[model samples]
Target: RSAGVSKAHDPRHAAKMFKSAQEDKTGRWLAIHFTSHDNPHISRDALEELIQDMSKQSYRQEILAEDDEIQLSWLVYRAFNERTNKIDDFEIPKNWLVYVGHDFGGANPAALFVAQDPATGNFYEFKEYLPGAGHSTAQHVDMFKELTTGYSVIWRSGGSHQEGEIRQGYSSHGWPIVEPKINSVKAQVDKVVGTMELNKVFIFKSLHNRLTEVMNCLWAPDAEGIPTDKIKDEEKYHLSACARYLYCNFTPDTVVHNKSRTSHSMSM
Candidate 1:
């Protein structure tokens, strides 16, 4: 759990249960997912043509497939691709509204820092922190402080699989975190998808880890084989979770009003 409770009342409780049941060796559930690619009833040329179409708009194909994308496919797909969202040589505004997002699940927890262009209401992810296990909470806090030394950080938000971890752990450790109000992972993920599609948010080229996880993040199909909010190989998607948390908690009213320093950029 990121910083919250790990129990049944969670929004994504069904997905967690699905994955768990699939892994159980006691024969309670036998998960089998198949696609048209594996269908013996289709002709070779028809299959090839279908595969070509699927490649062009894989997201829809995943949902339509008979197996319902059991293997899963890229979550953000081409929407968040480098051609659309990656920015090089982005200048950090001397004065801007700052927001930090966290994800405590998975082996590699993630912290994403975003600075909003106060005037434009656009957000730029300039940095990321993935301090793996073995580091103390104070150490992580110090690192977070060092990363955001100058900017005025206005919001800190995130979620976890366990109850109270988000509300209790970080607050106790000097970092107060408020969980997102909308609990549906789909809604949060849709915000990220829309942002990437609209190019409202961009990631600096230097943030390799952040870009990598999101680019590779895929939507996992539920037991019915339809792509769901559950992510595929979630343990590797700490940054994706961070991005989801950031966009879900963002509001237009949080823009900075600093007139002292103007927006500026320098060579990295």
Candidate 2:
């Protein structure tokens, strides 16, 4: 009684199968199609993560539950909202923890500035700088210095092969960098998805490049109809890489503790 819409079994065929089942009249004919976002058991955060982990066609058919032509679909498409999540510039509280995440590549050297709100345990990406080709490491370093001049920040770098070079260059200029052991791609992606699902992540409206990259990042599906770890349209994944690094490595200083009275402490 279960059927999936695929190239071999199109929606028309699936519909025919449903009709045949309905004609049997032995049991109630019930059919439901929905994406993970529509599932009550999945939270918004989990759903977002699920989408990010899906391939282009998988997202279209599985998450969207739509019978349409499948093409490259965004991995983080469901995680962001321009109206609610994107905002105008705001001052970072002096007491808030600031973080800078870097993704280094010869073509694109990307950095993202994130501020954690201690009171709400939310993280906001307030700015991004993606300098495309022809920029030297020194130029990148200078830009980083100028961008983060006034803020006290914890600098974290993605484990690029060129990381040592980047570190040496920055350190020579007196910028301290920390390189945490990078987690598996799946792990980092899961963390980013979970964090966003809790409504704990935001972006600046003016960060058009970052937003565009997020919109374009998609998974390449394997032959088995599952999303492969391979990602596509990666010209902008650099900032996303920075985000993943920050979310995976940076621990918020604020922790919300729950208080409750034990049954033994209550009046019997």
Q: Which pairs, if any, clash in model 2?
A: 45-197
TM-score of each: 0.63, 0.63
Runs of candidate 2 with Cα error greater than 4 angstroms are: 1-77, 81-83, 251-268
Best by lDDT: 1
What C-alpha lDDT does candidate 1 achieve relative to the native structure?
0.66
Q: Per-residue alpha-carbon lDDT of model 2 for 90-170, expressed as tens digits?
A: 877766767788777777778898877756667789889877889876777788778777776754556554467676777
lDDT of 2 at 186: 62
Q: Considering summed lDDT, which 10 consecutive residues are worst modelled in model 1? A: 259-268
